[model samples]
Structure formats: structure tokens, C-alpha cells
Target: MGLNAPLVSPRPSDGYDHRFTEVDYLRGMERLVHAVQELSLARSLSDIQRIVRTSARELIGCDGTTFVLRDDGICYYADEDAIAPLWKGGRFPMTTCISGWVMLNRAAVVIPDIYADARIPHAAYRPTFVHSLVMVPIRTLEPVGAIGAYWAQERAATSREVSLLQALADSTSIAMENVRIYAELEQRVRDRTADLERANEEIHQMSLTDDLTGLTNRRGFYLLGESALRAARRNNHHCLLAYIDVDGLKRVNDELGHDAGDSLIADVSEVLRTMLRESDILARIGGDEFCVLVTEPGGDTARLKDRLAEAFRTFNTTQARPYRLSASVGLALTHPESSHTLDELLTLADELMYADKKAATESRAGGVNTG
Candidate 1:
């Protein structure tokens, strides 16, 4: 290349090479602005590498450019844009490489002849096209890396070339810092999003559950029961809802205190849980009143009722409690296609439960009279 080739603009009418002229200076400024813009938009280390390697060479009109990172005790030639391959993807000790020296010294160096410079590792440069070079630290006060511009022939880099290289290196440092900031910000957003999701799920579960028995509450029953009914209607299936009221709850609460009454309710909940299948939806709909909705097509209400009676008998026989446990259960069976809503079924079940309580009271009175 000619003396003015690197910085010359197009020839004017006078056929003069306009190097170091106002036109050439404006063009250099334009290229530098474009490079800085590219660096500002870089999102990662690799992005910085790609932009720097290409833009540095273009701005300085060098034969090659390498972006070298200072890795702990080593100088890593991370990326390069060159006429031929430089030491890309290679690592050297901090004391052995020119790029490392630039970073350590926190200053730029212009080497006209690599052989003559005592800092140059002559054996290392013997086979390469690099003979003269200008290397600038990325950050001056505390350097993180270096950018090197290389030439195949021995030539002194002008002051303008060194300044341009340093400016680009400074921008590279800022771009790298921005990448770190963006990564941390993204991680925090992900963590906050996860925390919110967990909180929402816990709140949702609390709304649907009974505080004392840990069973599904009335609100849950209606929400889930309505959905189940809708599915049954679509599939032409049947549903059986059993409303169970704990017998003599008022007496237990009054005589033994609300604490014993609570124990009784919890015991009954356990019995129901033991007797019911995993698919059964059991809920504590009211104080001492529990409801079970069986949506399975093959469910037998009679068998379910028998199981409940047996479960209660087993609980009373096994536990030494002040009060005996018993429940009045009423089952309302219906096809969803009949247009019977869950509310209607629950109302019907409640009435049947009252009738069942009446029958049990009458049977006990009759037994006492006979005795």
C-alpha cells in the first residue's frame, strides 16, 4: 500500500490524494461514530468481539486487528479480522505477549519493528505476517483487555492511528460492562417472576381449603362441583352428592366444649377420608356438615353409605373419646343432562339428611321404650 493509501479519500479534480485533509478527517470521524454506535448496541462479549475486530481495522485501515482478553495470568486472543489468520483462539502468558504488556502497562504502544523491540518475543513473530503493530489497553486505569492493529511490513503507526485504536478500545470496555449489567437485570426479573407465581399458587390453595380439617371448603366444592357437573353433562354421565351431618354436634359442643366438638369433626373427616377413594371430592361445607360428590359413572351410593357407616363404627370402637361419632347421610343422584344444577342437588341432599336424622331419633326412642 502507498503512504497515503490508508487515510486517502477519492481523488479530486486536481488528481491529488486528499490524505490528512478536511475531507479525510470528516470520513474518519464518520467511521468512528458508526463503530461507537455498533458498540453501544452490543449485548454480549462475543458481540463486542465481532464489532471491535471489524470496526478497529476499518477505522485505522490496518492489515489485521485482534481483540485480546486478559484472562487471569494469560492473554487470550479471542477474535480477529485480518488479511490472513493471526493468533486467534490462542493463549499466552501475560509476560510473553504484546497485548498483555499493553494491558499491564495501562497504555498504548507503537512498535515500528517487532524484531528491534526488546519486549517482542521474536521467535513467536518469526512465522507470522505481523512485523509492526499498535496495541491499546481497553481501560486505561484498570485494563481488562487489549486491541492490536498489525502490519505485515515494518512501519511506524501515526499518532492519529493510535488515538483511533484507543477510542475504540475505550468503547469496547463500556460495551462489556453493559453486557454484565444486562445479564444481572435479566436474572433478577426471572427470580421475581418465579416468586410471584409461587405466592399466587399458595393464595389460591388457601382460598379453597378448610382451615381446621384441611379439607376442601364450600367455595371449593361449588367451584369444582360445577366444573364436574359440566363435564358429566358433556359425557352423559351421572353424579351422586352425599350430604352428611354429624349427629348430636350441638350436645358435644355444649357439654364437652367447642374443643372436643372440633376433635369430633376432625375424627369424622379422617373416617371419611379412609372410606373414600382418591377420585372422591369431599368437602366441609358447613360447621359439622360434610359433602361428598361422586362423579364416577359406576359409583354405588348404597355401597358408599355402607362404607361410611362401617368407618364410623370402626372409629368409635378404636378411639376412647367422650362422645360417640355418628353421621346422618343423604344422597341425591342425578344425571347432569336433567338440567339439575349443583345447587339444586345440594338443597335436596340437605332435606334428605334432615329426614334421616328424624328417622334415627325415632328408632332410638322406640328402642328405649322397648327396654
Candidate 2:
């Protein structure tokens, strides 16, 4: 008979001693149990894979060992050495290989002698020089991945060796679960933090905007205007503040209802937002009143007035309502040598606005109506 053929052991004089001696078997089992306990404490996947590689190499006395994980239907050798390159991220159809078959069935496969087994398909063993193989499905609540060990020469795997491998596979399953749970929890935390930041930003924006016309309210205007004035002063730059008042809003509201008046205000706000440069600030400071801060060189009042007039004309053409959109604009320029507070500047601008309103009304009624 060939050396590769199955051997029949001689019968011992003592029946119990014929098999493995009790003391030797117990010592081996104790060592395996300790090894499993050590593997269970591994926190990360890399740690678990390393433990698996080292433990398998020692326990099975194989030339090399590999650990693979199943992603979709494909097996990737998450950790392996060159001696068993086929085990590392190597692709094999489920119908063709021992590892794939074990994964599909969710059971352990022991090939005592790969060459002698008829159930073992020929094509599966063609990629590597593996002759003796033991594959165990690393089963969790759901099947995760698989672990396998192989010998270069054909041989029978001892029962104790198979038991140790199964224990190691179980340890790997638990470690994989821990790592997956940690990763998912970390992702959830990041998603929640991002969602909260978005909500806070929206709330902050709502607090700064006027409810009536979707423009910056009085409080927001003062806060922003003061900041802009300070910045311009520090940089030795010029800024223009234009205070505007709707000429006949009270009459329009009394005759056409507050809803129509509100619609006209919204239309004006949209026009001003569109006509001004993105750097300029447009704000609603009071009923039928708004303010704009324009930062530009030369401080051209005529250009600013023309832009306002164009915006008014656009609103008149686009709006379907009967009431016309008209505003009296009052502009003030900041000077470095002047000792004018923001409140004082605002008062001057307000006085100028009333003067413009008076002139506009007088001009409209041919110097008769000067309210």
C-alpha cells in the first residue's frame, strides 16, 4: 500500500490506552480553551484576523493560514500570506470551491484526504497545492464568513484539531459582530450631529428675518449695520445708508385692506433684493419703511436713486395689484472726521426721508399736498 493510503492502527494490550492517552488529550484541550478565551477579547477585525492567523498556524501545524470574509457572493481574503494567496480576496464561484460550498450550506467541511474524496469536485482543488483541508462556516445569528486550514501533503485531520478550529471560528464570528456594531454606531452619531447643525442654522436664519416681507427685521438690520460700519471705519472705507419710506401705504392699506398692502411690500422687497449688489444689506425697519446699506467707492447718490427707481418700475410692471409701489429714499454717507453715532446718523437719515416724502407728495399734487 502507498504511504498516502489510509492506515490501520495496531490494537493495544490495554483497550483505553489504544487511542490517545487521557492526560495528554486533557492538556491539549486546556491549552485550546485558553487560546479561545484570549481570542474572544480582541476588539478590532485586524486584531481578530491576526489572532486567527497565528493560532491556526500553531494549532494545525500548517505551513500557512488564511481568513476570508464574504461580501455579497464574493470571498475576499481580508488577511493572508503569500503561501496561500488563493485564500486572500480570491474569487471563486459558489458551485466550484470547498470554501464557497461551506458558506452556502452554513456547515463545517472536513476533507481528511482531498484526493480520495469523490464528493470533492476536481476543479475546486486545481488553483492551489492544498491536499488536506478543513473548512468551518463562521456562523453568527446570520452566516457572516468562513475560515479554512489546509496541508500541502494529503493527511487525515485529527478530531481534536477539528474541534479547536471550530472554537476559533466561533470566536471570529463574535469579533466580527462587535466590529460591525461599533462602525454602525459611529456612523449614526456623525449623521445625527450633521442634522442638528443644519437645524440650528435654519433656526438662526429665521430669527434674523422679517415675517411680513422675508427681509431683515429692525433688530437684525441694526446688528448687521453696526458691524458693517465698524469694519468700514477700521479699513478707512466709505459706506452709504439709504433709509426708505413707502409714500402712500397708509392710504392703500385703509382702502385696499392690509393683505393688499402686505403683497405690495413683498413685491418691493423682492425688487430691492434683485437690483442691489450681493454685498449690500436690505432691511425692513418699520411699517411702510425699509433701510439699505451700500458699500462702494465715490458714494454716487444719483446711481443709487436710479437703481431704486428701476426697482420700483419693475415692481409696477410685474405686480397685478391696483396699488403702485413708491418710496422716498434718504441717503447718508459716513465721514472719518465726523463724530456721528450710528443712532445719530439714523436720525439724520430719517429726517431726510421725511423731507423727500414731503417733496414727492408736493410734486405729485402740483405743490398742494404736502403731508
Candidate 3:
């Protein structure tokens, strides 16, 4: 029974009650409290390992220490610290390992002979200097991991020694629990924060865009048009502001219903989109009013107006819609030498649009295209 016998015990309540003196007991308690307190500050699994491994190896007067955790149904030899090399990164199954037996039984075992115990595999200890050891389940309730203290020479483990190791195991359980809870909380906050950012982005996009046509609304027009104006002014370029009104939006709304009016607005937007370059700014400013900022150095407003009119004519002739679509456009130009602001430029375009509307009303085009 030299170094292969099993001695199972329930710790401090075990048969070796008279082992510790009053002074030694108090000193051990003080050290145990300090160690357990430090475990709370450990933020990671590695931190927990470093704290437990060093403390167990030193406080228990052992040559080495190990922290074996259970993963799935297998016992994982997760970590260790020793004066000599130990099983720091090896794994063992629950069926044949001593650490597994203690964990499986949810009990503590002090082995004076590693070769003698049925649970101990002979070949496993042949390479190491661990002749005897004490292993304790991390939790008495539901064990997650185990802590082991290994001795170089065969010796009977004192009741005090096994008790301290059990205490360390229990402390580790609490420390790991704290780390798990903290990690879960951090992940949840991160996920929630990401969700909020996405929602805010969607809201901001909605604010800048018109719900009907998926086009830039008045607010978006002002913001983007201002930036385009600044760039044009800096680069000594020409900028065109076009004020447009759908020719028969109200009549279409009255005759064909609001849905037809909406369809007409979308069709007009498509024609306007095709008339401008990618760098141009187009926005639906009001019910049937739109604005455009052409950003080229020498843009042709006449050509753009003609193209939109032609596109509308082509679309109206090709598609059999309830009503034809047409637009009355007004153009105002801003160059580098111009002293007018964006608001003044837009006002000038609107005035030109009203003048065009007045002229068209006076012409004999049916009952005077009334405003």
C-alpha cells in the first residue's frame, strides 16, 4: 500500500480533527480569506487559473498543482503550475482518470499511492514525479472543475491539507461563476448597443428621404445642395437650380385618384433622374414641386429640361397610363462670380417657374392651365 491506496474523506469533518493548532488555524483562515477576496477581481479564465494555481501549489506545500475542468462528458486537464512539468494541457476521459473519479463522485480523494488506486492509470504517472496527490471537486453541489495538489514523494495527506484544497476549489467555483455572469452581461450590452445604432441609422435615413418616391426630400435637398454649392463656388464652377412643378398633379388626383397621382410623381422622378448626371442633386421639395442642383462647371439647363420633357413624352406615348405626365421647369444659374446665396437662387428659379406657368395659362391650351 506504499503509494497506491485510496483514502476517501469528507474534509474538516474527517477523522483527523486534532491536526491544527489554534494559532495555525487562525493564520490559515486569514490567508484563505485574502486569496478568496483576490479571486473576485479576476476578470478572465486565465486570471482565475493563475490565481488558483500559484496559491494551491504554495499554500498546500505541494510540488505541483492542476485545474481540471469538465467539457461535454470528458474531463479536460485545462491548466497546471508546478516546480517540474505536469499535465497542464492534456485531456482525460471521466472513466479512467483519478480527477475524473472525484469529480464524477462529487467527493474528495487523498491518494497516498498513485499506482495502487484502481482509478489511477499506472502509465500516466510513470513520466511525472507526482507520487501521491489529493483531488477535490470544485463544487459540492454540482461540480464543474476539480483542483489537485500533487506531492513528489509518497506521503499521507493531513486532514488540514485536504481541507485547504477543498476550500480553494470552492473559491474557484465562485470566481468562475462571477466571471461567467460578468461576461454574459457585457455581451448583452454590446448586442443591445449595436441594435440601437442600427435603429438610429434607419431613422436618420428616413428623415432625409421622402417616403413616397425614395428620393431626397426638402430637408435632404437643403443639406446636400448647400454642400454642392460650396464646392461649386470653391472650384469656380457653374451650378443650375431648377424649380419644377408637375403639370397636372391636382387634375390627376381629382380624376384618377391619389394613387395615380403618386404613380405620376414617381414617373416624373424617373425622368428627372435620367436627365441629370450622377453628381447632380435632385429632390422632391413639395407635393408636386421638385428642385435640382446641377454641379458641372458648364452644365446646360436647356438640354436637361428638353431631355426630361422628351423622356416624359416617350414614357407617356409608350405606356398606357390613365393620364399623361408633363412638367413646367424654371432654371436659375449660379457661377463663381455670383453673389447670390442658395436660398436667393432657389427663389429666383421659383419666380421663373411662376412666370412660365403664367405664360402657359394665357396661351390657348384648353381652359388656361390653371394653377
Candidate 4:
């Protein structure tokens, strides 16, 4: 298409005339600004690419156009047409080629006649029948990409046309920068949401864990106990709670160091966890107190107690340590008809635990070893 064909604006004063009226220049500037706004508001990268190609084709009045961008240290042409394949999928070092030259120099280059300009290497324009071309770097101070338009017929580009393309290139730069900033902001928002979710999960875990033994703490125990009670009350089934108190833990802490005391607590917690069912809840409430909430009331309660005793036996026999890990356990059963509240049931279990501890102490004083 002819440059002054009026396709873009009113025909430029007929013929090889390079001069432009002041009104024509202002109208072209206004059109360039409108095109830039349209491109900037594009929703996706694909949409932006389409708009860029169409804009270049219309603004520069070329038969074919090529749009290219640099990403990950590699240059890629965004066009799919096969007529002008400068380096289709072939790598061009950013130091060479008209597009690369414009990118590196960060300025617009206009060639009135491609064959006459010494800078226009002959081999570059040989593939396409293009004789005259104009290249404008689509960027601000730092070049991000370039847009090139080619003509099949040999014709000289006017100063007004070159200036108009430069303005359009500048608009392209702003649109590209705006899109980049928007994408970065979206990515940052996603990253922040993921970080918040991770932090919330960690906080939840900490709230349910005991600081000393790494087991479920008192708050965890009550929460689990309440849920179990509600389930049993709903189904008219039964559940049990076993309150356990470790024997002679305070004496060990006083005689040895706090590290030894911590080791003892951790070992006991591990034993309890290993002996219980995966569905059961094991929590450390006080310095040497723990609670296990079993789902079923009758047979499972007895089985869980046996498992706990076996775990302690195995630990005492395997370890060469002088101090023994032992506990007094008290059981409390809850049924649908039971009148006791959750707290009341726990109080009854605590009283039974004290009775067991008293009986164990009496036996120890009588020089009778339960083990």
C-alpha cells in the first residue's frame, strides 16, 4: 500500500511530496494515542501481541509486519507469516539485525532506500522483496522489544511518517511496561496469599502442640474430648478417657538436670503415641500428666490400657537408664444417659488417678516392686 494512500489519514498533498500540514501531524498524533490506549487495555499477552501486529500494519502502511520480544536471554519473533522469515526460530544475537540494532540502540532507524544505505546489509533484505523499511524500537529509555514494517515496492519514507512511527513506538513501550507491571502485581498477590495460608497452618499446629514433649497439649485434649463427647451423645454410643500421671518425674528433674527431665518426658510421650490407635487422641496436660481419649467405651478401653503397660515394660527393659517410666491411669466411661458434663467426667477420672497413685506408693513403701 502507498504511504500516502489515505488509509491511515487524509491523502498527503498528492505525490513525492515529503512536507506535512500542521493539522495532519496533530491528527496522526491523536490517532497514535488512541491506538496506544486500546493496546494498553488488552487483557492477555496473546491479545496484546495481536493488537501490536495489527497496529504496526495499519500505522506504518506496510504489507507485512514482524513483532519480536526478548525473554530469558533469547529473542523470539511473535509473527507467524512465512513470507518474511528473517530468523524464524533461528537465534539472532542481540548485537546484529535491524531489529536487534534498534533494540540495542534504543532508538528509531529509518531507511529511505534499503539498497542505497550502507548500514542496510544487502543479505538482510534479500529474503523479502522489501526495498524501503522503517524500524522503531518499542521501548522507552531501555529497549524491551522492536517493531519493523517492510514494503514490497521501493519507496522513500518521509520525515513525518518516521516521526509518527516513533510516536507509535513510544506508545507501544508504555503499553508493554503497563502490562508487565500488572502481571508482576498479580503474581505478587498470589505469592502473598500462599504465604498467609502456610503461616496459618503453622499457627494452628503450634496451638494444638505441647512445647515440652511435642505432644498434643491441654487445649488439644479438651477440644478432642468435647468432640468425642458430642459424637457419643449423638449416636447413643460410648467413649472413654484415661488420665495418666507419671511417677517420680519431679524427683528425677531435681536429681538430674532439666535436659534429662525433658528426655524422659519425650520418651514417655513417644511410648504413649506408639501404643494408642491412630484415631485416639493423646495429650500432655501438666508436667507429668497426660490424657488419652478412646473412641469406644467397653473393650477398647481395656485393650488401650494393656497397650500402654506393654509399652512401658518394653521401654524399661530395653533402656539401660536407672530411672523407670511408670504411670497411674484412671478410666472414666461416658454413655448417652450419663449425667456428668465433660469437665465433671474429667474430675472423676482425676480422682481415680490419685487413688491409683496412692496404692502404688503404699506398695513401693512395703518394698514390693510392681514391675
Candidate 5:
């Protein structure tokens, strides 16, 4: 008979000793101990497959072994270590395969004669040397896969061999569970980190922004204004600092409600945004005070003042309100190659703004409306 032909040895009824010797038991135990250690360190499914494929065969003294995974209703023979090829990278229907039966039943099976057993598809074994086999589920509760050991002759699988194979499958199941848990933990940490970064960025933006006017606050002005001043000085360019205070804000707040004062401030901020170029740095530094830093050389202060007066005139003519919108403006110009600091320029602008406010108040002493 050919080597692949059915080689059915008589069963234990013929008094043949089918069990391995005590020395073989010791060797199997030694290999199993080492396999458990390796499995404990496995990080992925492929790692488990690699460690189990060879270790299972050595531990059970099988002619061939296969690591099978249950892919939905399909049984996939993913890896194998054998004397000859035994269905590596092959797929079969879960209902028609022995490994699938083991996984679906969540138990182990030991087949002594491939041709006699109804569970074994006899036609599938005709091309191979497999005559007997032992299949065990990876997990007894909810089986994920199965480990199979095949022999070239008919021999009843001893209880010890089945136990050893089942132990290996249990370890593999634990390793796979660990891999899943580790992946979930890693994803959760990444998600939390992204959330924290977004929150921190929002907090930073809130710290530098004025809540009422939606403009830069005093801290932001100093931070960005210093950078602009340094750049202007390095280029030897003339820069201007303009300080403006809204007129009659306190009077409006005292007469009308604070809501009207807030609306007036918002309107003033909108007017300043419309008058200034996009590159100009504008900030609300106090309750009724605003500042602008123009870094470019040759800014026209007279034209800017004229545009502000015209805009206020148009607004007062169009809007019906208890008080008109007006502001006292003062400017401090730093010449090219000047050594004036940003704080010094702001102080100078504040002094000039107070002087302009005094002049306007005196001019209104002739019974003329100032706002």
C-alpha cells in the first residue's frame, strides 16, 4: 500500500500499548511549560499562532498539527506544523469540518479511525496520511478556535494527550483576550489625550480674549504689541500707538441700563474694526478704553481721525438713541531708530488722550453738544 493509503491499526482490543512512556511524559511537560511562558508574552494573534503551531505538536507527539480559527461560519486552517502538508491556508464550511464541530460544540473530540468515524469526512482524508486525530476547542465556554493533532495510524488518543492539548488551547485563548484588552486601553488613552489637548487650547484662547467685545484683552495686547514693536525697530520703521476712550459711556450707563452701555461698547468696537486695517493690532484695555498699534511706517493720523469723525456723524444721523457715539483719540508716534519701549509709548498716548478729553470738555462749555 502507498504511504497515503489508509493504515488502520487494530484498536486496544488487540492489546497494543498506545500510551507514551514516562520519559516522554516528562519531555512533553517540559515543552508545555516553556510554551505557557511564551504564550504569556504574546501580544497579537499572529504571535499566538506562531507559538502554538509548533509547541502543540511537540507537546502531544502528533504526526501533524493545525491551528484553526473560526471565521464566522467558516473554519480557516491558518497555520500548521506537520510531517507533511495538512491543509494550511485552506478554508472549509463550519458545518462540514471536524474543527468547526469542536468549536461549535465547545468541547474536544478524539477520533481513532478516520474512515470509521461519521464526523470525519472520509473522502477528504484519502489524499493525506491522517488516520486518527484529536481536536480540542481553544475555549470551553465560548470557543474561538481549535487545535488538532493527527496521527498516520489508528490509535486511541490517551486522556493525557487530550488534557495537554486542551491546556495549550486555554493559554492561547487567554493570550488573545489580553491582546484585545491592550488594544482597547491604548485607543481610550489616545482619545482622552486628544480631548485634553483641545480643552487646553480653548482655555488658552479664552485667557487672551475679551469676553464682552470679542477683541484682544490687555494681556494679549502686550504680548503681541511687544513683538510688533521689536519688528518695527529692527526694520527702522515708524510706528504709531493710538489710545481712544469712549465719550459719555459712564453717563449712558447711569441714565440708561448697563445693556445700553454694553451695546454702545460693541458698536464702538465694530467701528474701530471697520476703520483699522486687518494688520493693525487692536485691543480693549479698560472698561471704556481701546488701543491700536500700527507697525507700518507713514501711518496717516489726520486721515484716520477724519474717517472716525465722519463715521460717527453718519451713525448719529441714522440711529435714534438717547446719546450719540463719540470718542477722544490721541496718538504717540515713534520715529525710525527710536528706543521708546511699548509701555512708554502707551503711557505717552494715555497722557495725550486725557489732554484731548479736557480740550473737548472745555469746547462743549459753550452750550454745544459734545456727544
Candidate 6:
């Protein structure tokens, strides 16, 4: 906690303090450069999650790491890269989750003695290997997510560790924001091109677009998406199916009015359009919900996910709307080698989407620990 402590290396899991020399700084900076490069090209939330956890684990030297997303009054464990499995897909109430604590407070938190910390739910901690931890919100102003680093023994996260983790968080925020911007620009160009092709105007007008946003409607999605999947199977191509739910739609409707909510839907559609190819199928399956079927040449499951995250990130930045737009996306991919049916893919995608949505919702809560 000293002024110079942050400049020192993090405490190792062996309960020994490590000294950071000039060489370590150079190595750390080098590692960070690689992290940024990978993150910049990462087009999916999982990619971002993986990169964050791996980089933090290496730089902070923690025994375990996790990436959490807030959804619907809960903190959902979206991904993890740890010495032992902690909460990969479990849901925790905001008050009980340290990651949630960071998001709600919009600040970083370090608990050297998690058992002694009243903020931590002791019962939950009793089963985990984590005796100490550090958590940082992905963004400071209006944070959308958080990252957690855990230690197997009682140890303090040095100032240097906290600063390093925060830096990574800031970098992640920028990567997410850029994804949003790219998707927006890409959508605008597509819209303009479609406008120029006047020959198809009448057919498109009568087509299956949602009345509010121009995305394909539920019927259109099922019809078109199923066909696309069938084609992928025939051609032996891989496919990615994603279910997306817009975050805070109810809040936007309540705080900003119905018209604003409608705008949010339209803007999010633009994001979806940008993330996929002209060949891919996208549909507005429900109010504040979208489904994307992607399995085209030069596209894989990982690439589709990366682009999806970019769309959400880009929308949050470029759209000058009163409310910030974000989404919880669950993606399920069908391998060219697997004989998975469209119905099977649908069930998986829907279940994953709800799981992610639940996490985002719980992370936004303000009440007592809902353990």
C-alpha cells in the first residue's frame, strides 16, 4: 500500500514478495504489446475474455483468473483461465461477487484477506481456492464488465499489479469501442449500397424485415437461417449460430420512453448487419432480441464471435443516443464434420444467450448480496 509498492512486482503464490527490475518492466511491456495486437484482432467477447484473463494472469502472477459480465442483477462467470476451475458459467448476485463489486462501484478493488473482508460472502469463499483477489472494472465511466485475479494464499495485490490490470482493462475498453465503430461504419455502407440497388426495393419492402428495425423478422430468420444451415451442411462448411439480447432495453424504455427504445433497437440492428457478411442471415427474432446464422467460406466460429463483439462495442461508442447500447451474445457453432441439426443449434444458442443475459443483468444490481 506504500506509494512505491505499485512499482514493485506482485506477491507470488508461494507467499514471497518478488522484486521487479528494469528487465521485468521491459518484458512486461513486450508482453503487453503482444496482448494489444491479439486483442485488436479479437472479434468476439470470448476472445476478449481469454486475452484479458491470460494477460492478467501472466502479468499479475495470480493463481487463477476470471472474466465476468454483468447482466440482469447478477454477475455471470462468462470465461475463466485458472489453475483450477472456479466459476466458469455460474451466476452470482452482485453483492456476493467481487467482480460485481468493481462494476457497481466503477472502481478497482483488492482484498488481501478475503475471509476478513465483510464485503465478500464468506460461505461462498470457503469452497474456492481464492484466499485473496483483485478486481477491476472494464471501464471507469459506465462500466460494462469486470475482470478478477485470485490468489490461492493470503497476499496483497501490489500497486504495480493493480495499475497493470487497470491498464489492460482500459485497453480492452478501447478494443470494444473500436468494434462498435467498425460495425456502425460497415452497416452504413451496406445500407447505402442496398439503397442504390433500386431494382430490389419493392421485393425487399415486401420482404421479412421487422417493422421497427430493418432486420429480418422471426419468420424470415427461421426460413432464411434454416436454408443457410442446410446449405452449409451440403457444402461442408462451418456455421456459427448466435442469439443476442440487448442490455438495458427495459431501463431505456422506462427512463427514455418507448421511442428511444425503438431507436435502440434500430441502432443495434445496424451493429448486427455490420458484423456479418452479405451472405450471412440476421433476424430480429423478438423485441430487443436478434439471431444470426453465420457459416460462410473464410469464416469460422471464432471469427464470427469476434465480429459480434465488435458490433456491440461499436454501437456503444458511435451511436450518440441518450442510452448506451450493449448486448449479451451467445454463439454456437456447427462443425462441418458434425451432423448437428438446425433445431439442435437453436436450442444451444438460445440457452447460451439466456445464460449470458442472466449474468449481465445480475452484475448491474445495487442491493444486498443475493448469494
* Candidate closest to the true structure, highest lDDT: 5
TM-scores for all predictions = 0.75, 0.78, 0.79, 0.73, 0.67, 0.48
Better of 3 and 4 by lDDT: 3
Highest TM-score scorer: 3
For model 2, how does the per-residue alpha-carbon lDDT over 168-267 read when each residue is reduced to its tens digit? 7887787778777877888899999999999998888788889988889888888898887777777777878888887677887899998888887887
Clash counts for all predictions:
0, 1, 4, 0, 0, 23
Q: Between prediction 3 and prediction 5, which has the larger lDDT?
A: 5
* Model 1 spans > 4 angstroms off: 1-26, 43-46, 68-99, 110-133, 151-156, 271-278, 314-325, 361-371
All models: lDDT?
Answer: 0.83, 0.72, 0.81, 0.72, 0.84, 0.77
Instruction: Give the least accurate 10-residue stretch of model 2, judged by summed lDDT.
Output: 362-371
lDDT of 4 by residue, 221-274 (tens): 888878878887787877788888887778888998778888888888988888
Per-residue lDDT tens digits of candidate 6, residues 191-295?
988887774775665577788887788878878877888788889888888887787889999998999999888888877777568987888989988888877
- What's the best-to-worst order under lDDT? 5, 1, 3, 6, 4, 2
lDDT (Cα) of model 5: 0.84
Report clash pairs, candidate 1: none
- Order of models, best TM-score first: 3, 2, 1, 4, 5, 6
Backbone clashes in model 2, listed as residue pairs:
77-89
Report the CA-based lDDT of candidate 2 relative to the real structure.
Answer: 0.72
Candidate 2 TM-score, C-alpha based? 0.78
